[model samples]
Target: MEWVYIENISEYEGKEVEIKGWLYNKRSGGKLFFLLVRDGTGIIQAVVVKGEVDEKTFNLCEELTQESSLIVRGKINADRRAPGGFEIQVKEIELVHLAKDYPITPKPHGITFLLDLRHLWLRSRKQQAILRIRHEVIRALRDYYDERGFVLIDAPIFTPSACEGTTTLFETQYFGTSAYLTQSGQLYEEAGAMAFGKVYCFGPTFRAEKSKTRRHLTEFWMLEPEVAYYDLDDNMDLAEDCISYVVQRVLDRKKEELKIIERDTSKLEKVVKPFPKISYTEAVNILKKNGIEFEWGNDFGGKDETIISNQFEKPVFVHRFPAAIKAFYMKRDPLDEKLALGCDLLAPEGYGEIIGGGQREDSLEILEKRIKEHNLPREAFEWYFDLRKYGSVPHSGFGIGLERVVAWICGLSHLREAIPFPRTIYRLSP
Candidate 1:
C-alpha cells in the first residue's frame, strides 16, 4: 500500500497511486461522485465515474459512511477546480475497516460532547488541523531552545521534596515514604543550571486543584528553562525572546495549519521580541490609575490580569509582585524588602499568565528564614539550601504552560482544545 499527502498530488498526476485511509466526506452530483479522503498529512477528493468500475466498488461507495477505512487503487488526474488541485480516479476499492455509526458527525456538537468524544473526534479535519499546529508549536519550542545552547534535562516526576506548598502536589506512596508528583520542575531545573550552565525541562506536571476553571488543569505540560549567572532582568529578556522565537517559528513553518485554524495573523504579527516591561510598583500604579480598585499587597486577580493583558500590544512582563504572595525562594528586592524580584508574563487576549518565574534567593540565611516563615519543612529542602551555602550564582528560570501557549497561538478559546488527551478537572477517563 502507498500513502501520499494531498499537497503533493500534482506530481503523481496520471500515475496510478495506491492509497489507504478514512473517508472524510462523500458527495454526489448526478452521475459523478466525490469522496474526500484524508490520511493525516492532507486531504483530497477521489472521483468515481459511473459505469466506469465494477459493481462492488459502486455499491461500496453508495453504502460507505464517514470514517470507514478503505484501501483504494486509483489513477491521479489534474483538476483545476479540485480542492487540492488534483483528483484521484479510483479503479479499485477495498474496505480494510468499517466504522459504523460514528459519534462525531458533520453536524454541530457541543463542547462537552466533543470533548467526551475527543479520541474519536480527533480524526475530524478541524481537530486534526489544531493538533498539527500544536505539534508544530512543540517542535518550534524545542528548536528554539536547542539552537540557543540550552541543554535539555529531565526532571524527576516523583520527588521526595515539595515545591512552594504541599497542598497542590499529587502525593503517592513509594515503598514507605511519600513521593509527590512534580508541579513545576523549576527547583530541579535550577539545580541543573548550576551544573549545566543553561538547562531546560519539558514534561508533564500535575496539580491537584478542585477549582473548575478553563484555565486550570489537573495535569498539563510545562517547558521550563533555568540559567546560571542570569538575573531577573536577564530572565525577562530571555522570556520575550523565547516567546517570539516560538511564534515566529510557528508562523513560518505551520502557515497552512495556521490558515486552517483561522488564527488572526494581525494579532500574531504584533508578537515581536522586546516585549514591554513594568516594575511591580509601576504595574500596580498603572492598574490603580486605570480605576481598578486593588490593594498594594494583594495578588493580581484574574480580572486584573485580563485588564493588564488588554493594554499591551504584545505579551507584557509584570514584575516584582509582593514578596508575601510569591514563592518563598523568590529573591526579595534589597531596595524594597517587601517585594520579590519575580515576574509573570501575561499573553495578549487575556491568555492569563502563561509564564511564572523569578530570580532564586542565593543567600542561605535569607532562604532559611523565608522557608521557615512559610511554615514549610526545612529538612526537606536541605539539598536546595546547600547551593546557597556553596558558590551560588545569580540564577533565574520560568515555565511556559504548553497548552496555554498553544491555545493562544492557535486562537482557541480554551486550553483544553490544545492537547490531544487533556486532563481537566472534569475530565480523566478518555
Candidate 2:
C-alpha cells in the first residue's frame, strides 16, 4: 500500500492509500463510524462501515479514542460536503497507540485551562491553522530578503550589554560575568551590513518587561534587516516593500488557513506598495483632532499607534520622532537636531508597530556622546563603537516582530496564540 498524507489525498482520489495520523474526532450512526483524522498537513474524515469490514475491524474502530495514533488504509473519495472536500473509505486499521482519556475534550474550555494544556492544545484545528500561517510568514520574509541580495547573518542571543536599554534586559550569569539576552539584533546586524553590504538576522529575542498587555510577550522572534548606504527615506521604502511582499505571499499561499482563522482579508488585500506615510508631528496633530491628548515629544503608545493606523487603509509609517525618546543609536534628523530619523510601521485594524527602524548614527563623536547621555556603560560598547571608528558608511535597518505580524494576520485576540510556547510575565510551562 502507498503511504500518503491527508493533504495529498486529493491527488490519490479513487485509489487506496495508507495514512498514519491521530484521530481528531469521531461520530457513530448505526453501523457507520465517521472518524475525523488529522496528520498535521490537513484533516479528513474516514468512514468505516460495519457491513463492509470484518467484525474485528469494525470492533477496532469502536475502540479508537480521541488522539489515538493509527494507520488507516482507505480509498480516497471526493465529497463536496466533507472537510477538505474529500473523505476516505477506510478498509484496514492498524492501531499504533490508544490515547486514554485525552484531557482536552470537544467541550468549550476556559482560556487559562486551555493555556495550561497548550502542549496538547496545539493539536487542535484552529491552532494548527495559525501556526501554518506563521510558517508561511517566516518563509515569505526569508524569500523577500534572499531574493533582494541580502545575506543571512545569525546574531548572538547572549550579549555583553543591552541593545535598547538596561531596564528591559534579561540579565544572566555567564562564567561569573553578568550577561543579558538580546533584545534586538539591530546592533549586530549593523556590523554584518558593513561587511556584507546587505544582511538580515532572524532569531528569538527576550525582553524582561513586566507588561501584561495583549500585545506583549516576554520572549518572541524578531527579523532584522540591515543595509549599508541606506538613508531614512530608503529605509522607509524598503520597509514598505518588504512588508507588502510578505503580506502578499500570505494572501496567496495561506488562503485556506486565513479562512480557518476567520480573518477579514479585505484590509489585507489593500496591503500593497506605497503605503501611506506621515511624520510624527502630523500623527500627533491628528490624534489631538480626534480628542486624544498626546504630547508632541512623547513616544507613541499602543493606543496611539492604533489610532494612527486606523486613519489609513493599509500599514502606515509614522516617522521622525523626538531624538530623546528613541534609542541612542538612531541618527538625528539633519534638518532638525531634536528629531531622530526613525519610523514605526503600524499595521492597520489595531495591530500596532510591527516594524521599527531608523538610520544609525555613523559619527563616532555623536555616538559616544549619545552613549554617555543615556548613561549606558561605555566600556561594554567598545566593540560596537569600533565600527564607527573604522570605515563606516551610512547604514539603516529595521526589526519586525514575527509573532505580532502573525497575530495581526491571523486576527488573534492575544499575542500568546501566535507562538507555539509563549513565555509571558506570569506564566511559563509546557
Model 1 segments beyond 4 Å from truth? none
Residue-level lDDT of model 2, residues 371-394, one tens digit each, is 999998899888899899889899
| TM-scores, each model vs. reference | 0.97, 0.98
The whole-model lDDT of each prediction reads 0.87, 0.92
Colliding pairs, model 2: none
lDDT by residue (1-430, candidate 1, tens digit) is: 4666666777888888877788888898556779988877788888887788687888888878889998778899889877878889988788888888888878998998988888888998778878988888789889888999999998999988677774577889999989999988888898899999999999999998786877878898999999999999999999999999889888888888888888887898889999999887777887898899888888887888888888888999999888988989899888888889998999999888999998999888989998889898888899898887778889999999999998899888887888998887778968
Model 1: lDDT equals: 0.87
Task: Point to the candidate with the largest TM-score.
Answer: 2
Off by over 4 Å in 2: none
Instruction: Write down the lDDT that model 2 would get.
Output: 0.92
Clashes of each: 0, 0
